[model samples]
Target: MNKTENSRRRGDELLESLYNATMKLATTTKLTNLTFQQIADEARTSRTVLYRRWSTPFDLLQDIYSYKAKKLFDGAFFDELKDNGSLRKDLLQLLTVYQKVHTEIGAEIINNYYFLRAQDKNDNNELLIHKQAVEKHLNATKKILANAEKRGEKIRKISPITLMLPYDLIRTENLIRPTNISKKRLTMMVDEILMPVFVG
Candidate 1:
């Protein structure tokens, strides 16, 4: 490979390693206590590498969260979701995939980023990060509802808070139980909770 290509590959590898280390640390360590030194030690890199990029662990995590969240929504699953034939099926499939993605990204990491974001009331950039993530989720939910409308299903004009239900519900659920949230409970979320509010 050319020098430029080799340099790009090396940078990508370092980023992947850093992201992996941060996520792994998130499970056992609180974000409140996370440090550049810990991440460098875990990633087997120097603290200067982290310091050069992020002013704080929260900043680094924001990038990591954005990176991971993009991967979740960029999948073709949602594009084919409208054809699932029923609202309940669509919700179950949606939440199930969300659960899997959150599991893969580390539920603790998801929760920590959100919690820290929520606690920061003065930072415009932090608020922007949260808003951007929320918009992506809301757009996905709106598409599902819009598609259902095309299918002749009754779509309600719910509030923005309600539109955020799918993201919040599964995020909190997966964090609470980690890998232990049963498919049965997932079905109940679709049947007992989501269907009534979104459809009925």
Candidate 2:
């Protein structure tokens, strides 16, 4: 590789390492025990990189949350959302993936984020990151709904927020109770809310 290519590769490696370190710390340690120094040690890099980029752990975590949330929505989570000729099946699978994300990382990260944000309400950056992530998911959900509509389902007029009903409910369930959401509950969400919205 040329010099510039080498430099880019090195930068990417460092960033991946840092992000991995942050995620590891978030998952393994208590929220109160997180520090850039610890992350640096875990990542085998200098703490200055984190300090120069983010003013606080919350800021770094905002990036982490946004990145992971994007991956969750755009990555393998949506791979099976194509026209399967069954809206119920597609929705159930999608909800199951969303629930997996919540059970795996979303619950702890989001809970810690709210706790930290409550301690310092001036962090508009975190809020912006959060809003962007939510919007991304909303768009993805709309795409899925559009697919169902194209498949001859009579989807009703619904606002963006309303489109997020199933996802929001799963997120709330994760926050309230850190356990695997039952497939029955997911089916009920579809039968009770999603089906009505699409078929009503």
Candidate 3:
């Protein structure tokens, strides 16, 4: 390969290919059955390229999920968070978009990485991933709180457990429902559960 082409492949283009390849395979192959050879073949890149960065398919999968989740945070749904008029309204919209992005990232992968595999005592990777996801949502919530503050709404200091209600509620519901949590249920969560905490 020419130096220019090789350079491009070594850059974002290569990472993108690897991420795409991983997700493509993940869609059909259970994580237990996934192989680096399959990912390398799908990406049309060498195992050397994969090995230079990742030691195992598990590591690559973790990075792929982090990349995908980060992109979702940077996407257009965030703009929709602007001035949703009330904390309750803003949260409902925020979580609807949040759940949509999570759904797009695929629940099976999340379930494996975050919940199911926790029993194996894998490592701190899942904890880090969980923290990253929580921070992104809370950062978005910060905006909602700021906007609510501007509109003369009261904001309160919530304990960590109370602060986590939105994420836990949505996450639990998603696990039960699996990519299909209803708008009605979300509304009820925001109104009946979340509104009391944020606006109480």
Q: Pick the candidate with the highest lDDT.
A: 1
lDDT measured at residue 112 in model 1 versus the true structure, 0 to 100: 71
Ranking by lDDT: 1, 3, 2
lDDT of 1 at 14: 78
Error (Å) of candidate 1 at residue 63 is 2.4
lDDT of 3 by residue, 43-109 (tens): 7766777888998888887776667666453455566656767788888887787788778877866
- Descending-TM-score candidate ranking: 1, 3, 2
- In terms of TM-score, which candidate is strongest? 1
Per-candidate TM-scores read 0.75, 0.66, 0.70
Give, for candidate 3, the lowest lDDT window spanning 10 residues: 1-10
Looking at candidate 3, what is the lDDT of residue 123? 58
The per-residue C-alpha lDDT of model 3 at residue 162 equals 66
Candidate 1 deviant stretches above 4 angstroms: 1-9, 24-28, 73-77, 127-130, 150-152
Q: Supply the TM-score for candidate 1.
A: 0.75
Which run of 10 residues does model 2 get worst, by summed lDDT?
Answer: 1-10
Q: What is every candidate's alpha-carbon RMSD to the true fold?
A: 4.8, 5.8, 4.6
